[model samples]
Target: MYHTWMRFFTPGPAHHRLGLVCLGVGLQHGTLPTVGPRTLDHHVAVVVSTGRGWFRTPDGRRTAVTAPALLWLTPGVPHHYGPDPDTGWDEAFVDFTGPTADTYTELGYIEPHRPVVALSDAGAARATVGRIVRAARRGNPLLEVETSAAVHELLVTLRRARADTAPDGEQVLQALARDACKPLTVADHATRHGMTPAELRTAVRRGAGCSPKDYLLGIRLGHAKELLAATELPVAAVARRVGYDDPAYFSRLFTRRVGMAPVRFREQQAHTVPGGWSDQVPDPDDPPIIGRTPTG
Candidate 1:
């Protein structure tokens, strides 16, 4: 028998507001029943372990995800999923909370909730599934760190998968990330890409799901996170590094979308590292913003 497990959170104080949960799901050589399109008030995720399946989302989007692939479902959007008929499917899923939950949604990292994805080249998926399953088996503080590390790896995998699909998108994203610490405009980007401003805007939205300007801004914010977490730099320097000339404006934007100011988020992360902080960190980079918004 397949059992569904879930966890919910009741927000009270800032420190007590986050929630996390995971489930191991399976369906024998039979069709998995269709369920209502459910929306998460927080972040959610699904990883297929075996078999093949198709899922129809609330918006009528049909996704064909096979074993070893991942289905990232962010909060506030209607979602529905089930097994594909040619073969049955088994899956593992996890949901958690943090300041970046909304930011993930804004980037479309969790939208269209049920896209069938190829799980090829995802080193983190295997390790994460193992960690989550082990945690369910062991249930200890060690599990918490393992799960958190796995989640971070999964997020990075999703970002990479988005870029690997479109080299142009990847290039554009890198450019945006690298330039995030400076002032830029679509026209400037278009000129660099050898495209007209209008053409660039259309291309960006079509491929990345957001206008170039918004995507660039996201990159800047992502960089701001790096400076806050990995360095001792003040928010002002971080803002400038990510292309925001005005620190106050950057802080406001970060707080509004990311749910916390840069300083607060940094503090929160400082105390939450899975292990001791490492000096060897990536060069404060921003990932390409794919799925920046809903397609329909």
Candidate 2:
């Protein structure tokens, strides 16, 4: 008494090397039959968009599943679930696996412990799955690559839609990014936000998946790379711009993290624009070249 549309794929080794591959995707509704208390080799993200159900782990603990909710069926984990017999439920699922899945799990994007996650909204996630569905079209040449990319987007969208996420943590991340180049210590930044240093670390770790110091360093070094590659600014000036008062320390830190000296990175990444380096970036809305027509 259920309607289901699903497609499974066997991606080539090259596609698997892309860090994530789509194993399958499906959309289902109505009073679907119960899923087994079986184990899987890969992972599946079962997004319940409507109605209700219950999920059971290997330990036989059953948790209520209400829309919009997400269920993570990780590798080697036994899972069992079914819709409420009377009401049924609408569900969309994407199965994926690759080396990067482990990294994503470590970063908290894929929660193995929290099997069933309540989501604030499933629209975005459903839309991403829709993209995968469209890519699943018969005779589509880009099916593997396109669907694989959508799986990455789906993971990010689901993480953002988690119901337990706090707005304050996001606000703190935004504030930290805005003041990333202010030369403030973690303690200083925490004080400005009316939070203790430990609290700041917790907030950043929850929000950005890293410590406050590491988050700030990531922002600072990213900007430094842009300046080094796009501008003719001296290394010292670039360091200062990114909040490193001591140029030598900045270079050392940059090398340690970036795996090469800044100068060497610049030499490898420097690009020459058609009109040469300009301090002002052109507005997207502005006409293509002052007097030239854009070509398709």
Candidate 3:
């Protein structure tokens, strides 16, 4: 959601040789209204705080930005983007331009071709946007110098995101497929193209060093382990949570993958507690029924 009011500069008496303009725009939780496309001579950067959306340039390249992506727009580039209908978007944006405006361009930093750059540190990017917006609104004497400095940091972050994409590409895909479902099979993945299951298995192994089934199993077991470590549920409950209904089968698979049975793993961890352990207390914080006492 873009802010409803757009600030503009006055032409006459307001005109000055050294002008520093800053505006802060924020949208709450609602669908973005239709906006007419336009171009500007100022630098524009949008930091999406929540939800998902697509940034489409006039040339038809569309980049998707969700919770982790920052959008960069340069002067004189025609652009249009808004929130997805299902989930409304939240974003902070700032546009500033002056004599030192070429600093961003000189670095070849603005890549509107890749309109949305996913932020490695989303929190840091959000904080930076807040600072940029405040600096612009301050109308300080050194606005150009301060704003340019902030822009420099933003450019470096953008470059780092570009470099990080390649290494994480396959991992991201595997994670996506695994999350799509526990029953996600190699045949289903292979059908992503016209390829067969063997081809998909070969490709996944070549790129990820593991078969598709093994990769999916790793995801499932990783999820099961987290449940075991974080919750007090029984082995059956943990197995069900990770998509297995039969505790025995889940235990067999877990032992095969983890080199230990689930109960053994839990017992090993319990023995590591300081004063020994007891399951007599239904809740860890409450007092035990009879002979049980708190662990040291």
**Top lDDT prediction, candidate number:** 2
lDDT of 3 by residue, 1-296 (tens): 34443333232223223443342333244577634377776667676768898878788777676866677777778888878888867666666555444544443455545667776656665566555556555346655555556655655555555434455446545554556334445676667656788876665654444667776777778767766765667999888877787899999999998999998877665333443334343665664557766453
What are the lDDT scores of the predictions, listed in order? 0.63, 0.93, 0.62
Candidate 3's displacement at residue 68, Å, is 1.6
What are the per-residue Cα lDDT tens digits for candidate 2 across 55-74?
Answer: 99888899999999999999
Which has the better lDDT: candidate 1, or candidate 3? 1
- Scored against the true structure, residue 269 in model 3 reaches a CA lDDT of 56
Against the hidden true structure, what lDDT does model 1 obtain?
0.63
TM-score to native of every candidate shown: 0.53, 0.89, 0.44
Runs in model 1 deviating more than 4 A are: 1-43, 59-63, 66-68, 72-80, 97-99, 113-123, 137-139, 175-185, 198-296
RMSD of 3: 15.7
* Native-to-model Cα distance after best TM-score fit, residue 84 in candidate 3, in Å: 0.5
Full ranking by lDDT: 2, 1, 3
Which residue pairs does candidate 3 place in steric collision? none
Estimate, for each residue in 1-296, the C-alpha lDDT of model 1 and write its tens digit: 34444332232343333332232322123455655578766566666667777667666878776666776665566767777655656665666667655555555555543355665544565555555555554336454545555666666566555423567766766776666556777788788888898988766765576888887877777767766886777888888887778889988999998998888899886543454344444333543346664222
Name model 2 segments beyond 4 Å from true. 268-296
